[model samples]
Target: MQAEIGLIGLGTMGSNLALNIAEKGHDIAVFNRTTAKTGAFFEAAGALRSKIIPCTTLEEFVGAIRPPRPIILMINAGEPVDDQIEALKPLLSHDDILIDGGNANFHDTIRRNLLLDGTGLNFIGMGVSGGEVGARHGPSIMVGGAQASYKRVEQVLLDISAKYEGQACCAWLGENGAGHFVKTIHNGIEYADMQMIAEIYGIMRDGLGMQAKEMAPVFAGWNEGRLNSYLIEITAAVLDTEDAETGKPIVDIILDRAGQKGTGRWSAIEAQQLGIPATGIEAAVAARSLSARKDEREAAEKAYGALGETLKRDAGPLEDLELALLAGKIAAYAQGFAVMSGASGDYKWDLPLPEIARIWRAGCIIRSQFLSTIAEAFEGAEKESNLLLVPAFVEMMSEAQAGLRRVVARAATAGLPVPALSSALSYFDMYRQGRGTANLIQGQRDYFGAHSFERIDRPGAFHGPWAMNAG
Candidate 1:
């Protein structure tokens, strides 16, 4: 069947995604704030230009696409998404599909879905990942909206999405904002993983006194082991490169500071409001902030020279035990997913946690072998809520606990900060511990306010007489 897709932005990602769709035999109509951007796409696609019609106005763009028009918005995440939706509404008919393909805040998505309820326009909060190249080829897509609305456009999405074992990369995540919520947490986990990789790089470099070139082989070897992943594989490539002119290692020459676009921070903030522990994500954000303090760190390093000692290498090979590190990383990812699970429960989204893990096994940043285990954790559980308590994950945590302790202790002893990795282990420990010190504070609340508390000795009741009198 012929499908006509409208693209409202021709930025790097939009342009590439449009091309990918066109290449897949679907016709695409392009529109942009700047007409020139759309023109460039038309010129670049050449003969494929026949598949893409550039429109000067949103009205013309909407008019050009087929009925029940599926328009994908690839604009900036926040206010810009709002602006585009407002501009497109008057031009769109009821029951038309509006897909937000940007990194929009999930809360805003929830509000927008409600706002468009009476308009008959279907709004889908879609999380598209894999970046520009992924767009040009295939990316992992997370969609959240009415199931019927998702079914309406699933074919088009499937054609453009990266396939994994014959399943479409696209899945109906849940209702309303669920898609973007998963994406937000996906990005949060991404931040943690990237920071952890950087920490490992730092440990190998500063702590081990290994050059970037020297480190490439180690990473490459690790990639062949249980720690194998796209990130580790790419890290090997990153370590191998050197500046042609300066003959200095590329990684060493690059700036120490890292930049963030705010999604990770937003995830942490949401976790706090929801009373969920997102320690891995929080550490990732902290790692970025620490990166921004390069000058202060350099100064301190100079002032405290010789006081710091280098890391001592482990006596023997850890080849057989690399699964320990892998297991800890899996627990970190599980904790991140647990945060999303909590948010979904609170929002009444009914998200499919198992499918989320399955879709994430490819295209996305956290795509790793461990995700299969996470998917199994959800599937084997009696209820979806039991994912964290699954036997496999619990066993993985148990196996990794000692290695995590050793890694954290070694990093501390060597004066190296492994914030993301360390915090991930801490989160795993805390989750398994089940009981928290915060209950002491809750006890104090009952003591002072006469608030009801569940009696450890018996059951639930109002504890203090003074609290009952105050009430």
Candidate 2:
């Protein structure tokens, strides 16, 4: 019998995803450029080996799949993806679907769709999250393609996806690049979340003089409360781990520099292009870039002295820290959703905010109990409503904002850097302000560049007095 679906690339993620498909009782045709790796993958399948057809050539792989085939390319993003698609195009029949399961830039996805427009091939920009383990068992699958094309493979996707309360964490979000765009924004929020958490860790370490061993339980406790999520749970485990070689805390021994594969930056860029402010994400990206300047940082520290020694302050209650994190999280998520809303309008994708939240509640790295609340909030909210304006979150922010205020104030006084946290707090403050200080900015713009400013007292744009004095 012909295989139900086909997969190319036998790298770690690709191999695991193929096994996952096979484990779901659907026969899968798998091919890799390296034929030996394909044999190894089939051998490693063990009990599920019978369900996977290992093919050495693209022709064999395409032939093994049934008509109107759905072939997933789990290879590297960019040129490799384009090259692979080109190789498979002639082999695929009319309506044969090609899915790019990589962290591709959304613009590339759109361009690829246009490139394949008249080729009788269908394309899907699918964003699969949860890493290697999730790929092997279950992943949060975000698909962007034609509705009819998605309908053909929806069952297999749902079967292989993670579940929350028996509902699959998989959906066809929109046409073209919506899935990848959402995934990019997801990483951007992830960066903010992680940076805020790390800032808290810095406070505990520098401000409170608490060691990693002492901080693990604190994180463990938070996991049982509102901050509960996969990231928090893993943070505790990571804190508790000791370096087998040096016997020091693993995190301490690890380099402070973090690496980026471009998704976070892409999210921030897209948000800016869409005229939405993702301050927390921008701060996190900036933080990572700054962290990479180790030599400059070291030199600056030598010249200016360490920040922790500049001021001393009593640490606030741990409850304040927890609440502060929650508040910051709300701001980051609110900004992320706002960016998506803006993109939906600009791209005319009509992205479903509620379904996006629902799928993120499981399988994805950012999975949290908080996402369930977000999903519910979006259900009844207007399409353009900010998440902070949702009644439930309004109450939440009302309570949590005070804690955030205290934390930012304390961090500032102590000369501790909490860029993401501070940015989130500032974003919240700016968002809620009825009268902002931007009037001065408008005046400055008008004085220098003849830019007009709108007045609350008048309906039309008005020029500043400086315009009358211009030479």
Which pairs clash in model 2? none
lDDT of 1 by residue, 1-471 (tens): 223888888889999999999999889888999988777778999878778888888778888988989999998988898888888888888789999999989899999999999888999999998788778888889999988999988988989888778776778889999898888888988887788778777766767777888878877887886677777788889899988989998888899899998889888888898887878789989989888998898998789874366766663214212433565567557667778888878988878888888888777767777677777777773754534577776676676667667766777788888887788677766766767787777778887765667766786575665565654
Q: How do the predictions measure up, each by TM-score?
A: 0.91, 0.97
lDDT tens digits, residues 1-471, model 2?
799999999998999999999999999999999999999999988999889999998999999999989999999999999999989988889999999999999999999989998999999999999899889999999999888889999999999999999999999999999999999999999999999999989888888777899999999999998889988999999999999999999989888898998999999999899889999999999999999999999999899889754324344547788999999999999999999999999999999999999999888988987898898888873633798988888999999999999888988998899999999999998999999999999989989998989998869888988787986
TM-score of 2: 0.97
The local lDDT score (0 to 100) that residue 58 gets in candidate 2 is: 91
* Candidate 1 Cα misplacement greater than 4 A, ranges: 1-3, 302-307, 314-324, 381-388, 434-454, 461-471
Off by over 4 Å in 2: 310-315, 381-384
Q: Which ten residues in a row have the lowest lDDT in candidate 2?
A: 308-317
RMSD of each: 3.1, 1.6
